[model samples]
Target: MDHDNILETNGLNHWFGAGEVRKQALFDINLTLKRGSFTVLMGPSGSGKTTVLTLVGCLRAVQEGSVTLLDRQLNGATEAELVALRRRLGFIFQAHNLHESLTATQNVMMGLQVHRGVSDAKAQTAARHALDLVGLSDRVSYLPANLSGGQKQRVAVARALVGNPALVLADEPTAALDKDSAAEVVDLLKRMGAERGTTTLLVTHDNRILDRADCILTLEDGRIVRVDDRH
Candidate 1:
């Protein structure tokens, strides 16, 4: 791994089942993500983009190779160790995944609750700051149902950032939004990366935001076929 890189995966392979029914989702993948860089992963459906994100986020285990995040090895890491590693990662899914019963501010604060010794006042303060960063200060009191698709996603982003994680993993965050909304969300991501120096890895089919990424990796049939540096 390069000294400047925050994530590195070598000979990473993942497979399911056995014999004739075996399925390979990723194979012989090697990649590096530098700290404070915004990277995007794009591929056709079933091309393993989501799998790569999940693996790096410690949501899935590496079946064949090795994964290192923040200088910690992920392969065969114990449950406790993985949990600790995951605390430095934040994930955003296509569904937003906010609690319908909770307001946007409350939802964002929920992320801070995972860490010990964080008081409610501190959590709420952090959540408000995150929402403000994402341009959602006014919507903090709204519930998921009261918000638009993009607003809901911004709240999700707020939740992701509230923890001040070293890495942010987003899975097709614009999938459920309109064109204008999608662009808005992508712009917000760009601003966040530029201003905060947070490492962001977004898995998306949207090509419009490709130019905004500092690095782009394309995957096909479970392998990284190409890497591009836009900066």
Candidate 2:
């Protein structure tokens, strides 16, 4: 494994379902991601893009081949090991996935509370700073129901980044926003990744975000067809 590469996959493959319904989702997928780089995974639905992201993100059990995340093998890692590894990553989903009952600040604080030994005061301070970075300082006390779709997504971004994770896995994070809001979200991810050397692997179908990526990877029928390096 190259230390500079935050993620590496070699001859990776995955399957779903069982018996006659069993189907292959990934085919000999080999990929490498450099630290601090913002990469987009693009393809039509059922192209295995999300599967690749989940494999690298440790969200699913690796079924075949090799996946080295942060220099640790994920193929047969114990559940405890995987749980420990997950603490080092952050995830942003298509839905904001915020707790409706919690204030924006409280939602962001949940990000840090996952890690052991973080005090409530310290978590509050970090959460406030993260919200500020995402331009949500004033909305920290607002509930999810009170915020706009863009503001909700911004809160999700703040929550994902509050831990200062080594890797961020985002799935269609900007899919629900308007043009300007989508741009803001993508640009924010790019800027924060650049500044903190946080590697980002985002899965999206939004064409608008292509230009912001350091690299763009396209998958087709469970295979990588093209890799465009814009940086």
Candidate 3:
């Protein structure tokens, strides 16, 4: 394991279905993300961007190749080990995925619920602070249905960051937002990566996000085709 890298994959490969119908989804995917770096994975649909994200995120088991995350190999890990590793990661999705009945604070608190032993009061306080960081302090009590699309996404961002996870995995987080909202969310993620030393691997096709990335990896036909490092 390289001390500076938060994630590393070598000879990563994947396929769906059994031997006869197995269709390759990823091939020889060798990649790495430096600690606290903000990396974007871009590719067209069916180019296997999400597959890489899922593999590195520990959401799916690694079939072939080696995945070392936070210093642990994922290739033949048990389910229990995967569960513990996942707790150290934060996830954001295009849908926001907030519970409709829960208020912003409550929703954000769910992020901490995954970890055992945090008191309710502490969780609530942390949730509120996270909301404030996202400029939603005044709307902490609002439910998802009551908040604007951007505001809801901000809540999602807060939830993802509330735990101070070592890494964050986001899939098309800005896809449903307007121009301003998308920019706001992207900026917030960058800020978190800078201030909290949080590593991020965001999967997006939106070119707007490219400018904010420290590095961008472009995938095509299950292979990384381009690597752009911006400062």
Candidate 4:
């Protein structure tokens, strides 16, 4: 693992089932994500893009080899340690996953609630700041139903960023938006990366936003086949 990398995977392999019926989702995956860099992982459906995102987010346990975040080994981390590690990594899924019942501010505040002793006032302050950073300050009180697709996604991003995470993982963030809205979200992400010094890894099939990525990686058949760095 590279000492300067925010994320590193070595001989990583994930499989389902056993014997002849076994299926491999990722195989011999070795990669590193530099600190404060914006990287995109692009691939067709079922190409292990989401699998890699999930593994990095600590949503899935490593079945083989090693995975590390901020130099801490993830494959051997305890449940409590995994929770702590996840708190330092923000994740945005294809679905905005916002609580329909909660307002945008409340939804963003949810992330801070996971911290051991964050006060309500402090959480609200952080949530407000996050929403403002995403250009959603005016929609803080709006529920998901009242917001546009882009707004909902922005709220999700705010929720993710509210924790002040060291790394941000986004899965198909712009897939549900129109071209203008998608570009807006991409710009927001880029600006966030630059302003906060957060390492961002975005997984997407959306070709339109690829140009905004500092580094682009292509995965196929559960393997990373290409990497292009424009910066």
Candidate 5:
């Protein structure tokens, strides 16, 4: 219940399917992420790294154990409550899932549309500012097809951050970019966390991100086996 912790999980467990086919994907997981901190979840394939992120991000239900996200218990939260909680979270995936028909600004505006009471003018202004923050002021009118891979990812970052969510969940954000572009995206996230106090929990296999993380947790066989604290 501490105000300083953005996310906390105690004895968290997850299972997929049901009946005889039910299979456990996560064991008891205990994790705490402080506000404004940048953390990375790293592990091999099928290691339950994505499971943990989805649980905290409200993308999936917590089967067993407790998960407190943004100070609310997700164990038995209603669907409406989950929808509201999801509005307060920003998610970035390996693929920059921007609408092909929408321009960069229009795509970023989609992020602000989830929050109630945001006028079109306000959304446009915020989108411009967000794109500017990501160093894409000139590309606001550009479509996703016209942009490079890195530019597309930056637009995704801008969209995720435009809402000013309390937490950001990123999964392999830099996977498709080149080395330099990948570094730029990671650095931008770290800088944004410091400036806006936006806690970030990223699941990535990129080693380049480890150096920028305040904490690095390694998951193996559904359990946390190592925690490297750089804070």
Candidate 6:
């Protein structure tokens, strides 16, 4: 029951496959993400960075050890429980994943639709506010097909944050953007963390954004090898 931490993993180990062909993926991984803090996970490919992210993000089931997210333990949690927990998280992937048929506001409204009681009008209001926060207020009615690469990513960011999720999990979110766009997206995420108290755990290989992280964790061969805490 650590109230200050939004995520905690203790002795976390993961394996792929079963029987004689089984292979271990993650070691005894242990980490903690404090509320409103921004953390970056960086490592070489196949070093278990994404594995850790997926586990803590509730996209994958925990095989061994404990993973506590938002004051609830993930180990042995039912599918229904996991689904409920996932609604509280915001996820941003490398791909923008916008529906071509939808406008920016409509796309963002999709994020809030997962909740039980939000109406379309209210969702649209929240989505517009989120787009405004991400500097996309003018593009609310624009379709994703008409937007630039960076603008599409901004729409993705707005979609993720519209729900007011407690934690935001990003996997290479800036990979597809240009230099300036990447910086802008990262800066927007940092501002959101500062202003909204949204905790973020991002997995990135882009070194340009490392300087902005409050804590940077480096993994190697499925083990956490370095932790650089700027704060």
How many clashes would you count in candidate 4?
0
Put down candidate 3 lDDT per residue, 1-231, tens digits, no spaces.
Answer: 888899999999999899799899998998899888999999999999999989888889999999999999999999899999999999999999999999999999999988899999999999999999999999999999999999999999999999989999999999999989999998988888789888999999888878899999999999999999897
Which 10-residue window in model 1 sums to the lowest lDDT? 189-198
- The pairs that clash in candidate 5 are none
Q: At residue 225, what lDDT does model 3 achieve?
A: 93
What is the per-residue lDDT of model 1 for residues 1-231, given as tens digits with 9 covering 90 to 100?
676788999999998789999998898988888878888998999999988988899988777888989999999988898899888888888999999999999999988876889999999999999999888989889999999888999899889889988889999998889988888887776777677767889999988778778889999899889989887
Candidate 4: tens digits of C-alpha lDDT, residues 42-99: 9889999989998888888888988989888989788888888988988887799999
Comparing 4 with 5 on lDDT, the higher-scoring candidate is 5
Off by over 4 Å in 4: 1-3
Higher-scoring candidate on lDDT, 3 or 6: 6
TM-score, candidate number 2: 0.98
lDDT for residue 110 in candidate 5, whole number 0-100: 95
For model 6, which pairs clash?
none
Per-residue lDDT of 54 in model 4: 86
Please list the C-alpha lDDT of all candidates, in the order they appear. Answer: 0.88, 0.93, 0.93, 0.89, 0.94, 0.94
lDDT of 4 at 175: 92
- Clashes in model 2: which pairs? none
> 8-101 in candidate 6: lDDT tens per residue?
9999999999999999999999999988999999999999989998999899999999999998999999999999999999999999999999
In the range 11-50, model 5's lDDT, one tens digit per residue, is 9999999999999999999999999899999999999999
TM-score for each model: 0.95, 0.98, 0.98, 0.96, 0.98, 0.98
Error of 3 at 67 (Å): 0.7
Model 6: lowest-lDDT 10 consecutive positions: 188-197
